[model samples]
Structures are given as structure tokens and as C-alpha cells.
Target: MVDLKVKLGSLELQNPVMTASGTYGYGEEYEDFVDINRLGGIVVKGTTLHPRQGNDYPRMAETPMGMLNAVGLQNVGVDRFISEIYPRIKKYRTNILVNVSGSTVEEYVETAAKINALDHIPGIELNISCPNVKEGGMAFGTSCPSTIAVTAAVREVYNKHMMVKLSPNVTNIAEIALGVESAGADSVSLINTLLGMAIDVEQRRPVLSTITGGLSGAAVKPVALRMVWQVAQAVKIPVVGMGGISNAEDAIAFMLAGASAVQIGTANFIDPKVTEKVIAGIEDYLVRHNMTSVAELKGALQA
Candidate 1:
């Protein structure tokens, strides 16, 4: 039998497939469509320190092979999530993580501290990479010093595993990864979303409410792979590679490129059962190759 289990920081998974934050609602939303416990991990939707209305309508637009979204960071905030959402998802068999986002450093620290209070929540994926918000969204992620400041601050308060999400819009992704590592981040999730804009020729205006939104889908796989490879080589901490992962092949590619694991985003909307399929597919790949463990594939890429 093949051992598909993989280690992500302090968390262990039956497999390496995880549902991306924002794309996968608080784990319970897909109970009818998926077996929530089967997933290696579930990252709940992005939650801020306080409630946010997010951006206006027409926040998502489809481009060739991908889509752009500016959904802002609309959520019921941390308090509601702790009181309501946490109690419900805490029972899941697998790791249940909160994807925390904030407009400022203080908010991030506060939100993370609250999540840390929850016994069942094992970790948090910081949303310093979110490009949809107008205020303190991607700013904290792009700059090295700012990344260190925010991550270090949260590291001081949150005791559990902290995964800092990295923005792909920056010039040097490895530099950002190293910066977060220095600040006490347990692991880093990279290639959140590429900033892109769609145009409506007939209307002669931008397609999204925010004009430019985070681009995701098959189009970002190459870039995501490159960044993941660069980061895995640069930093000692494990890297969670994401962006345009549609199937087991994509997930395996990421593992081979040195990603400890991967997250499914846009593909979830196209098919709610995709996560299960990817998990099964990875197992099949291991069996076919006569590999006993999934960890063997990680960073196994040849020069």
C-alpha cells in the first residue's frame, strides 16, 4: 500500500491536497458535495478583524484559460467566525485552518490571536497577498521590511502554525520567502494570484469593479511552479505551491518542484468533487510508480 501522508510544518495530512481559502467556504458549505474529512486540510474563507462589505458587484471576470476576481475580503469578521463558524468546523477529522486577512498590522495580529484561542484550529494562512482590497491588502506582502514587521508581530502572539501567503506581483519571490522565514513563519504559501485586468471592448471599460483583480486558473501554473521552485530552494521552511492546479498531475508537479503541498482554488468552483479526485489521483500515481510514500516525490525534481 502507498503512503500518501505528507507533513506541512507541524500538521500531518493523509494526502497533500488542500482546499484554498476563499474558494472553499468554511468547510461545511461543501458537506453535501464533498466529504470534508477526506481533504488533507481545509482553509476557511478569508476573515478580517472586523466585518467587511467587500467590493461592489461585477467583482469577477473570466479570461482565456483563467479568471480575474476582486471580491475584496468580505466576511463576517473574526468574532463571528470564532463564535459561529469555528464551533461547527472544529469537528472535522482533518486540519481546519483559518485564512486570516487584515487591512493593517494591528488587525492581522488581533485576528490571529483570536484564532489561536480556538483549540481545534491548527493554523492560519495570512492574507497579506490579497490584491482585491484597496487599503492594506497586498502592501504588507510585497515589501520585505513590512512583511517582516507584520509576520513577526503575529508570530509573537499566535502560537500555532502560521503560514504567510506570498504575493506573486513582487520582483523577487525568493527574497519575500526568506524575509517571512526570518520573521518566524512556520511555512509559506506562494503565488496567491497574479494581478491582471480584463477589458470589455464593446463597453470600453474594465470588466471588474476594481479594474484589476487577482488572476487565477490554468494560466498561472507555470509561474506558480517557477516561484515554488525558487522559494523551496531558497528557504528551509516548507512551501505550499498553488495557482492553476487542476488535477493530480498538477499537484504532483508542484510536489516535484519542491512544494510540500498544494491548494485547489478556481478548480473547486468548476467541480466541487475535484479535491477528492486529486487525492485519489495522487494515490494512484504513487501506486503506479511503486512508491511507498508521497514525501519521496517532494523536491525530487532533477536538474
Candidate 2:
């Protein structure tokens, strides 16, 4: 059998398949559909310094091949997450990656420090790219300075592995990637969601309550792959790529494009078992290609 284990910063994942934030909930919700331990890691929903009720109703809308979400980072506060959700998930065998968000640099530091004090949580994915909210959502991530400042502030507090999730809604993604790297991020994940909108001409209104939301699904695969490839080349730190990944082939594509690991997002909405299937598919590809280790495929792209 081929070895599928990989590393994201200093954390070791059983495989390259991890569940993205927001889509996977708190990791315990999907326990019935699939064994959570089988996954490399679980990136729980975005957690803030204070509990947020999120935006109003009709926050999600389906597009042609993708979906738009303006959920506004609805999540329990860090205190609640530790007092409630963390205890239950601590028993799981996989690495627990808390997906954290903040409206300001101070919030990110406080949240990261709190999670760092936790015994079971292994790392944190700084969600600097969420596009649905009004404050500090894509604002910090779109610019290089803000990204560096926020990441550096959090880095000083959170000693554990930290992966900075990047936004695709930028002019030069490579500059942002390098900025995070300089700020001491252990690794980076990309292409959070493309900014998009849908209009209901007949109703003379927008599909989502927020008017515009982040677009995610198979339609975004090509763009995501390109960004990941570019960021990987620009940074020495590991890159965890995600976008429209739905199958083993897609996962392999990301690995070859320079992703140290990959996360499955919208695909989970379609099939809860997608991550397991992707792991299996990767194994099959490795066996067929006579590859001994999956790590060899990292950044194997040709000129």
C-alpha cells in the first residue's frame, strides 16, 4: 500500500484530505456520515472573539456550477467553542484545526492565544479571506500590508502551526502569499471564494441577502489551481490548496500544482463521503503510476 500521510507546517496529517471551514461545521456534525478520524484534519467553522448571529435569512444561493454564500461568518465565540464544542471533538483521533476570524488584529491575537491554550486543538487556520462580512472580511486579506500585520500579530501569540487562508479576490495573489510567509505563517491555504453575485431580474432584487457573496464549486477549480501554483512558487512555506476540488483527480491536480495538502469544501455539500473517496482515488492513482509516496507529486508541474 502507498503511504498517503503528509505534513501541513509541523502538524502531520494521515492524508492530504481535510474539510474546509464553514462547510464542515464543528467536525462532530458529520460523524454519522463518515468517520471523522479518517480525515487528515478538521477545520471547524469560523470562530470569532464574540458570538455572531451572522447575516439575515436567504444567505445562500445556488449558481450554475457553483454556489454563493453570504452567511457572514456565523459562529460561536471562542469561549463558547472551548466550553462547549471543543470538549466533544477532543476525543476524535484526527488533528483539530480551528478556523478563526476577526474584525481586527487584536481579536485574532486574543482568539489564537485562547485556542493555543487548549490541549486538544492542534492548530488554527486564520480566515483572513472570508468575503461575506462587512468588517475585516476581505479587507485585511486583499492588501499585502494588512495581511502581514494581522498574521504577524497572531504569530506572536499562537506558537502552534498556523495556516493563513488566502483570498482569490486580489490583484496580485503572489504578493499576499509572500506577505503571509514573511509574517511567520507556518503554511498557507488559498482561493477562499471568488466574489460574485446573482440578480433576480423578475423580482428586481438580489438572490442573496447580502447582494454579493463568495462563489464556490467545481466552476472555480481552474482559477484555484492557477492561484495555488503561483503562490507555491512564490513562497517557501507549505501551501494547502482548495477551491472546486471534488474528486481524487482534483486532489492530485492540487498536489502536483504545489499544494502540500488540500481541503475539500463545497464538494462536501454534495457528498459527505467525498474526502474518503478522494483518499481512495489518490491511492489508486499512486498505485497505477507506480509511485511509492504521495509527497513526490508536490510541485511536480512541468514547463
Candidate 3:
């Protein structure tokens, strides 16, 4: 049997396959379609210090090879989530991580501190992609100083494993990754989504309510892979790669590119059972390659 277990700093996962935040809802919605206990982890939808109404309607648009989304990180706030959502999902056997987001450094720290109190939540995927309202709407992950500042602030309050999610809109993603690492990130996941926009030519207008949105899916895989490779080489912390992973091959490609694990996002919308398939497929690939452990595939790229 292949050993699929992997260590993301102090957190050890059953396997390297996990459902990305915003894609998998609190591990309850997909209970019927997916075997929650089988997954390495489930990153619940984004959670904030306070409730958010999110963006206007028509926030999502389908593209050629992917989709554009401007959902605006709508969540039920951390207090309500701890009281209502946590009890239900905390019973799951696999790891459950919260995707913490905020428009300011204090908000991020407050949200993360609350999540850190949950015994079942082994870690948090700090989403620094949210626009910093105090900084003229610039995303916290885009600038090195901002990324370090927010990550360091959250790190002070959050004692558990901290996995910072990197945004792809930055000029040098590796530089940002290093910044987070220095500030005390246990691991880093990338690339969050490429900035993109869709338009309805016939209507002579943009498709999404927000003119621009984050682009994700198959089209972003190559870019994500490159960023993962670069970040993996740049930081000592394990790298959890995500963006557009649809199958075991795609997941394996990220591992070979230097990712310790991978998260499934847009593909989860298409097939709720994709995570199960990927776990099995990874084992199959290992057997075919005469390998024994999934860990062997990390950074095993020929080039």
C-alpha cells in the first residue's frame, strides 16, 4: 500500500488531496455526493469577522476553459460559524480547515484567532487575496510588505498551522511567498486566480456585475503549476498548490512540480466525486510508477 500521508508543517494529512475553500461548503453540502471521511481535508467557504452580503447578482460567468467569479467572499461571519457551522462539520473524521479572510489586518487576526480556538480545526487557509479597504482596495497578497504584515499579524493570534493562500495577480509571486514564509506561514498555497473579465458582446456590456473577477479552472493550471514550482523553490515551507486541478494527473503534476499537496476548486463544481477519484488515481499512478509513497512524487520533476 502506498503511504499517502503528508505533513503540512505541524499538520499531518491522510492524503495530499483536499477540497479548496469556497468550492466545498463546510463539508456538509457534499456529504451525499462525496465521502467526507475519505478526504485529507475540506477547506470550508471563506469566513470573515463579520457577516458580508457579498457582491450584486450576476457575479459568476462561464468562460472558454474556465469560469470567472466575483462572489466577494460572502460568509456568515466567524461567531455564527463557530456556534452553528462548526458543531455539524467538526464531527467529520478528516481535517477541516477554515478559509479566513478580511479587508484589514485586524479583521484577519480576529477571524483567525477564533478559528484557532476550535480543537478540530487543525489549520487555517489565510486568504490574503481580499482587497484591503484601508489600502485603496489593493489585495493584501499582491504586495510583499502587505503580505508580510497581514501574515505576521495573523500569526501572532493564530497558534495552529497557518497556510497562507497566495494570489496570482502579483508581479512576483515567489517574492510574496518568501515574505509570508518570513512572517511565519507554515505552508503556502497558490495561485489564487488570475484577474480576468468577461463581456457580453451582444449586450455591449460586461457579463459579471463586477467588471473584473478572479479566473479559475483548466485555463489556469499551467500558470498555477509554474507559480507553485517557483514558490516551492523559493520557500522552505511545504507548498499546497491549487487553481485548476481536475483529475489525478493534474493533481500529480502539481506534486511533481514541488507541491506537497493540491486543492480541487472549480472542478468540484463539475464533479463532486472528483476528490475520491483523484485519491484512487494517485494510488494507481504510484503503483504504475513502481513507487510506494505519495510523498515521493513531490518535486520529482525530471527537469
Best by lDDT: 3
Query: TM-scores of the models, in the given order?
Result: 0.97, 0.97, 0.99
By lDDT, highest first, what's the ranking?
3, 2, 1
lDDT of 1 by residue, 55-165 (tens): 998999988898899998889999998888788888899988899988778888999998898999889998887433444345778889888888999999999999999
Model 3, range 105-176, lDDT digits (tens) per residue?
Answer: 999998999888899999999999999999999999889999999999999999999999999998899999
* C-alpha local distance difference test of each model: 0.90, 0.91, 0.94
The pairs that clash in candidate 2 are none
lDDT of 1 at 196: 96
Q: Model 1 clash pairs?
A: none
Give the C-alpha lDDT of model 1.
0.90
What lDDT score is found at residue 216 in candidate 3? 96
Pitting candidate 1 against candidate 2, the one with the higher lDDT is 2
